[model samples]
Target: MAGLFGSATLGIGGGTLSDLFRAQYRGKAVAIYSWSPILAPLVGAVLGGFISQNTTWRWTFYASSLLSIVIQLSGLIFLEVTYPPLLLRRKKARQAKATGADDLYTEYDHLDEGRVQVLSTNLFRPFKLLATQPIIQILALYNAYFYGNIYILYANYIDLWTNVYGEFIEIAGLNYIAIAIGSSIAAECCTLINYAIFRKLSSRNGGTGVPEFRVPIMLPATLFFK
Candidate 1:
């Protein structure tokens, strides 16, 4: 009933970006971090098309399973605990255990709530926000429209290339390279533009930081989407 796997994946990714990058570089770090997951599927589309054309489709599943296994093992072995609150809780528990103290605890230990409460809040948050905030509703609708068009393109791409353009399946997959290139360019451009705006805002605020600096970057993005 619950998506534990998806939750863990997002937690690890978001935690990694927060723990690994400085505040000034965080925007770029987040941009690059977000790019990988989307790029992987685009890359897979290109590879899958070629593989299915030349070899058995079974090989695609085989390769995917192998990659997933490797990533899982690597995560289990190599990933460090990046969440500060979790780390502090573990440290406090170790110290308390060593000292035989019942009262010693980390701040996070006291903030705990029932799992059901947490799940319910997270589940309802999107709907609540969409209902309450017109801006969020508009943004959600725009993103849904954009991604829906992308899915439509993915569905029809093979037919367009193979039937309309008279290209082979393997050759048709190369068309995805254009999408990949455009994504990379757009991501880099946005990263640079966002950082530039953030720097100016930070300067105008006498080097004090606020999240409002990030909102202007959306103007360019909205224009691009138009």
Candidate 2:
């Protein structure tokens, strides 16, 4: 999970969006990317409920494991490196290989920045940030609560519907329809409203943007969060 869609993918996606798109297109790109995390689990829960009901409950883990393996394998086969530092290092490597001299280097690959140093930095940076940055700590805590409740809800959702409502397992998955609809609407609102608010704020501030402009968008999110 960490290697695939957890912190690693979140970090990569944020960087990849900045690297791949201009500022004008970044918000829209980010909207789609951000919406994906919600969509995946909602879809997964519906499918998993049906799978568990007809087959053994253990099949849920097997199915998810298989899907994860397929996603990872596909990434290995088809994912392109969008990170500029990594891409630059690859180009430098190819050039050094062509010539006899193997002394090619970039600022990111300096003599002081060995593989061990880079690996350690990446491994511990999140923890360091979480400890040192108040904003990061708050965000981490909020997300812990947010996603923790969400996963717990999804985990118990099927049992709740089947037992309390006395619904058949096959149709119990249908209960998620309202959640799925609401989430879809929220995703669309995020894309449209965020972009509109940003543009409006930028215009109001003598054609410049302020971090304060982003705060209003968070107001709605915070109100709806719990």
Candidate 3:
């Protein structure tokens, strides 16, 4: 149940991040965010193995708890709301105070009624999109398959390393380095390709890039993932 709750929380976190971050920054941010999901188990295994070998298995839980506390403290200190609507609300309140005018305007203030309707629509929009939108349905199916393959690979990685390669626990954990290496290489390649493509498309489109410019890059990425 705890694991289920944690997964649910993570899904919410990812969705919130996607909602908050602009498309320009989201790719890099998501790539970095994704490293935690990939690295956590490998790090835990390494720490557990060291603790169990040097002292006791119980120390691993203590160490992880301490690290979690430190991370939570850091988040409390540094993280701030970056949503445009929230930021604009804060700005408007400050402006209203300074000018003594209650009629301060913000994009969010105009949407109070519409926002409620939009929220209601969003709640059921995913199912509607899947039923009506071919692009949405296809992309959803592709992403599901990709994520399923990734999970299967993760689940079998240790077996592949230990049984096939004859690695010890620590050595098996070290094999996660291959995942890190592949991720790093892919990141660099994608960054270069995306920048080049964006520049070309922007120039061709009279110096402005649209979301459509991103579509061409997705084909290669999908092919690579497959």
Candidate 4:
């Protein structure tokens, strides 16, 4: 339960940071952030093996805790809210100072409904939409299948490396680097192709791009995943 909570918190915080970055910088941020899940476990297992060999297994938890503390301190010193509503509030204040308006405020400061009711509606709407929306249902089903395949691959990969290839722990860990590299290359290629397609479609459509123009790119990705 504690580990699950920590993972959720990290995911939320990382998402918040990504939202703070501009669109131009977001691709690089997301790429680096996505790399952590693949790299961390492999690096952790290598370190854990060495640590347990030399000292004790308990030190692993202690080392992780210390690292978390350092990260927390750094965040406290540097991190700030990047949500548009909050930034708009600050911007409004500055504009008020420059123009000396007494009634300066952002749209976020005014709510037509109560906050508690809004929160409750927002939380439940996703469930309602998922229940009724065909597109959402189909996508959810597809995502479940994709995740299941990934988990199965993760579970069986070690056996394939150790038994089939006769590799040791470090060598098996190195195999994951190939998966990471392949994924990175695939993502880069897809991004470039997407940009090209978007450009061509925009030119064809009188320099205007529509969301439907992007749907064709998903076909290739779906085929690759299959």
Clashes of each: 0, 0, 0, 0
Name the best candidate (by TM-score).
2
Residues 48-72, model 4: lDDT tens digits? 5456556787987888788879978
How well does each candidate superpose onto the true structure, as a TM-score?
Answer: 0.80, 0.83, 0.71, 0.69
Candidate 1: tens digits of C-alpha lDDT, residues 112-146: 66889878997899789999999999888977888
Pick out the ten consecutive residues of candidate 3 with the lowest summed lDDT. Answer: 1-10
Cα RMSD of predicted structure 4: 4.3
User: Between prediction 1 and prediction 4, which has the larger lDDT?
Assistant: 1
Give the C-alpha miss distance for residue 26 in model 1, angstroms: 0.6
Q: Where does candidate 1 clash, by residue pair?
A: none
Instruction: In angstroms, give how far residue 31 of model 1 lies from its true place.
Output: 3.5
Top candidate when judged by lDDT against the true structure: 1
In model 3, residue pairs whose N, Cα or C atoms come closer than 3 Å (at least 3 residues apart or on different chains), thus clashing, are none
Ranking by lDDT: 1, 2, 3, 4
lDDT of 3 by residue, 99-138 (tens): 9999778867765557779888877887798999999988
Cα TM-score of candidate 2: 0.83
CA deviation > 4 Å runs, candidate 3: 1-70, 113-122
Worst 10-residue lDDT window, candidate 1: 1-10
The lowest-lDDT stretch of 10 consecutive residues in candidate 4 is 22-31
| 35 Cα displacement, candidate 2 (Å) | 3.0
